[model samples]
Target: MLKKIGIKDPEKQMLKLMESGAVPYRGVKQKDVRNALEERFEPQVLKSMTDEASLAKRYPGVPHEEAAYREMRRLTDELNSSDKGNLVEDWYERMYAQRRAGSSNRPESRQHQKVSAAEWNKNRPASEQIKKDRFIDRVDSVNIGGKEKPALHEIKSTKGKLQERDKEQFEDMMKVAKAERNGVEARGADGRMQKVDQVVYTLTDPRGVAKNEDWIVDQLTKYRNNLSFEVFDAQGKRMMIDARSLKRSKDGELVLPDGIRNRLGLK
Candidate 1:
């Protein structure tokens, strides 16, 4: 059916797209998929394929192709509608819901094994830790701090003011960090239990504004200061800064202060 419409080897094209990580899945943006498709096929060709009459005529005898075209049309229609960004978010939410439901249906022993694996993975070295890219609140990267303490970094990019959701997410990360600091000891790569003297919650906002920085600093100083978990730990002291003061490396990675960087051995 695709060949009939001058779309040669649709399966091969799709496979290539998937191999290039252009599919609309977790962490893959809708714009990324659109850009990839636009690069692969002519814009007019895509528009023609999405046209109702064209699809109906081209896919008349192929039920599978017809169903696929129907889905494509539905997605195209949704993209053209008012709720553009919400469609991808809603789809991901549904996927997460289904995953949770499936996990809940697992036998008790299987669930226990999963939990055990998670626990085991938690204490693994930073390089050995499993990546949780699918999670919205997952740690962006991990760094070794002074005395070899593991520090988790949460990176965010915004062109304007920081959102309340961002604060909430960072707070959640701090809570988890605090819990881990007080809980069981973490082992280093050498298999020795390492001490966690402090938990650092570093926010790397490359485009952060002054107002947002002041707001977050005030929130930390006035309310979260007593939380014991350091919002920005520099050496053994707690530190706060205007987001604009944050520096970046030549390669665009966030650059910590000389003291912290030297201690952490971060390049």
Candidate 2:
């Protein structure tokens, strides 16, 4: 019957048909089995199944068909929902602007910071100076001296409250910032060595809950002194006043304060 219907391999078609009907314990319906077989026998789908089977033979431990279906579904969903445009726009608006607007002297609104291995530690003993280079955390922004002192800005956006790892990361960053303030030079994107005068860490919560912000501020305060915090709504509206300035709104949803707004040039 399969050969009459133009199925190229009647024996394999019979195997599939028998497998589809083997689940009688679950009260399988004849129509369901027929639908399944009809889909499996479609020319393109059947060819894909054959290709997957061939690959399974070539590579032992690979599942026959279910794995292919799962991978195909995952790729399809990812392609459908990817935000490549938004990501590009964000990189341009945030990172590119910072890199191009070198130093705070440029009229651009943002600044950039890069940290690399300190220029080949010559003063240290030969054994200490030739240590293997390791990667440290990267700061989102670093503004070196204009109206305000040079500072490192680490921005984190979280849906919920900050985690333990976040606190530990802040501590490690503080060490780097302190070293920079103490005449330690860090290589920037332009390849010039620069030192930071201060450290400013910023945390942004997208959920914008008053309680969440309060808890985060408390946790950070106990962990370290002199950290900045910002909260924004789901729509990206500023929700909390600058914590550094020690101001709080009645409803916990306030625009950026005058000092910070003027410094950041935000409306």
Candidate 3:
């Protein structure tokens, strides 16, 4: 294209264009942009805008909306904690050296906090760091509508197959559980350990009526004469008790319904 326009060295020309902020596209010149920023904000504010350290120190307790400030504060803490070395210093400098352009006043796009140096230190391997970044970045993208996670792959139940050794270890755990006074350990088909306990029922009504023996006895006596009420019989079957035959116990305690008593084998 440049040759057709009577120009040679198109690559060099493109480089010059990019350097001048004109070739790739007509962007605001660096000088003009800086001048415009200065006109819009105070000098101190402009300095803070470019320098992360200055931004944090200037607005240490600013609201979360001021992400740049928060990021700077976090980075500052990381910088202080790490060894006094070129790697950390260079990392911080490289991070803040770039000028940020704001297209809008909304801060939703900036909510993903940058990866901290501490995180980077823990994830020493570049591959691990890349994976972590991808996970976080993908999550941020979904949250901000920059990207949507595929529905099918969203819920991954398993990462890899459970090894035979893990299965043996789980079986050993179950054996150990058998000797315990309560609770039993068992492995599920999904390779997860599950604890089982002897099941017991207790009424959980918050009104406390279920817990009051006297109240229960009174209610049972009042309902005893009602022939329409049903009760469970032996062999796990429902049966109706004749109102005339539903007698109150001499002890003033509610007698268990025949059906329930049969199920529990209680006299």
Candidate 4:
């Protein structure tokens, strides 16, 4: 009867259906067979089936273990092809880099393991820790004093949209910053000149960045502030000018901000 219904491995399929607890009676009516086939053939349903990890527990060793391993590898491959996967990969690289740099002073026993920022603070005295309402410190590597230190092993669900983007823009911005560190020539349009600690380039997105220009600039500004880097000017450089400093003169032409005027000691 099972073969008449087109079941290739009627005996095996019957055993599986019975094991699944979906079929009770050994008599096995046509509707029951049809229901099993319908459930098995649905792709969406199959994709959402119990994960291979759970399968490993039910069917331990040999073929089940091999199948579970292959499924895990396949799922990992699929994840690595997506935006989130790229972020996770980059974060792991950063964590490894920090660990290799010896930036963390954690004990020998804990050195090898990855500890989340939240977990790191869990048992510490309140005076020794900063209370974080959310897990922003869960970044793979966080800036500790002036050194970059790895803080967490596992990627928490708390990371927001910022992790989804590439850090290429930040890298390119750092090149301009390096020049500031070397020495920037601040030449004004009116033939004025001065040099400062670091030049902030405005209206510019770093290499490979073509979208969200304004938001990226704002984020860069915020990042610079957090890094304790002072904003500076290039002689007559508008890109380095603060938005607040950009104002309309009596003639309606764009003029430098009041801060710039004060910096230049102008009225």
Candidate 5:
């Protein structure tokens, strides 16, 4: 007979939970599991329930349907720490960047003497249409007789006046992810020597807000739960991308790609 480890019968109250089918927590040690059954009241469980019930209460007369964004800023830390959230924000930011890349983000616009770097950086929309400018320069509708294999065999540009900057950012994200996987060193000071494990994209919806593109209102109703997420290096030229991603879950935690993280102004 195999040696029986641990108490064969749990304490009086623990009998029900250990009976079967009651595992929901993560990184739970065996002893912790038994103790959990013994104690009817789990602090983690209570805290979770408390957090849920909090949504019902509201600050009265906050004006403009938002509570000054301060309470939410303080609370979204849980979402910020999740994997699904990271991915959704990334997609949102990339799209936002593409839109901003066009319009007034002209390269030479910063030549004026009076503008401080912070002021310029803060006010600059995604005017740098690197993708549009490059694609326009490189693309030709029909290949001439001397063309090797045609510049590209496929093109999947979106319809509807094609936003420029968002596409660039997404493409840039893919490239940075690929480069880091290939072991190529990126140049810079604080971000230079660091190994990038993941990338975070914070997408804020600036529509209908009093401020001009200053904050992300929120994600679509359906996708909010899986918003704070991430991507990981899978192999030579591929990565593990989660559409509904998060930083951590009931299973494990995730890190963002270093290069892309740096590019997106994340650590």
Candidate 6:
């Protein structure tokens, strides 16, 4: 689920973004953060982790031991937070990340006792965990009012399925953003540089991505015409400036967002 959200360090990155003024949707307070997060995640985005740490009561798609493990961990965190709803919410993410980390810390090369296929099937359900590598982040720059204005954009992927057309349309928006950035960069030294706006496209899905070829091609073509792109540093941060307020970076790149630069600390 976290894998499908397409963030290498979602908790950390999101924390940084929040500090940078990317407020939570619907104005979540510290108290509301837990319910907000449960509504936002847990079901789809945190499925993999939640399933891996279950309770003794047994949950569908999750077994007794793991569910029990999760329940125990939950109690531990509650104790640590003194049962404060907000603090518990914060600790919940950390605990979840820690559990995920612990589960993945093992060396995969180690081999255990072999078992018959039939026996393994009957007992191995509790051990199998989903392993996936998928990314869905997008960016764009566009022109507005035909005045060569720039609008930089970012797109987030959801865990659900999407129609190819919608995906392509999103890509088109990014292309426009990139093109708008280019036009502004090419603008003469009139000191009256075209304005640029930053836009965003966030898509959330639960069943994972569904590829759409025609939609992909259409988006690719449209973005090709725009020829717009946002390079990243190591941290998945944007590494370009908006058309209106671009300041050339020492590394021959434009000013980028802090969240992006942090993601790519190399730059």
Q: TM-score for all predictions? A: 0.32, 0.38, 0.15, 0.22, 0.20, 0.23
Kindly list the per-residue Cα lDDT of model 6 for residues 92-167, writing each as its tens digit: 3343324433342221111111222333233323223112211212122233333332233333222234555545
Pitting candidate 1 against candidate 2, the one with the higher lDDT is 2
lDDT of 4 at 6: 37
Task: Tell me the deviation in Å of residue 144 in model 2.
Answer: 11
Candidates' C-alpha lDDT: 0.38, 0.41, 0.30, 0.35, 0.27, 0.34
Write one digit per residue (lDDT tens) for candidate 1, span 1-267. 244446778878877877777654457787776556545554444445344566556556544333333433344432433232233223322322234334422211101001132553465555333333112322111222222333333333232476766665554444444453333234443445543222333332222323254455454453332222222211212233323334666886443446543432334
After superposing all C-alphas onto the true structure, candidate 3 shows an RMSD in angstroms of 28.6
**TM-score, prediction 3:** 0.15
Residue 262 error, candidate 3, Å: 3.1
Error of 5 at 177 (Å): 2.2
Q: List the residue pairs that clash in candidate 1.
A: none
Taking all chains together, the TM-score of candidate 4 against the true structure is 0.22
Query: Candidate 4 at residue 237, lDDT?
Result: 20
When summed lDDT is taken over every stretch of 10 residues in candidate 2, the lowest stretch is: 79-88
The C-alpha local distance difference test score for the whole of candidate 6 amounts to: 0.34
Compare candidates 2 and 3 on lDDT and give the better one.
2
Candidate of highest TM-score = 2
Q: Between the candidate structures 1 and 5, which one is better when assessed by lDDT?
A: 1
How high a TM-score does candidate 1 get?
A: 0.32
> Any idea what lDDT model 2 has?
0.41
lDDT (tens digit, per residue) of candidate 5 on 155-258: 21121222446445434332332332332122222222332222233222211111211111122122232222121111101122233322443455343334
Point out where model 1 deviates above 4 Å.
Answer: 1-145, 180-186, 193-206, 219-267
Clashes (N, CA, C under 3 Å) per candidate: 0, 0, 1, 8, 42, 27
Which ranges of candidate 3 are over 4 A from the true structure? 1-217, 223-227, 233-235, 242-245, 248-254, 257-260, 263-267
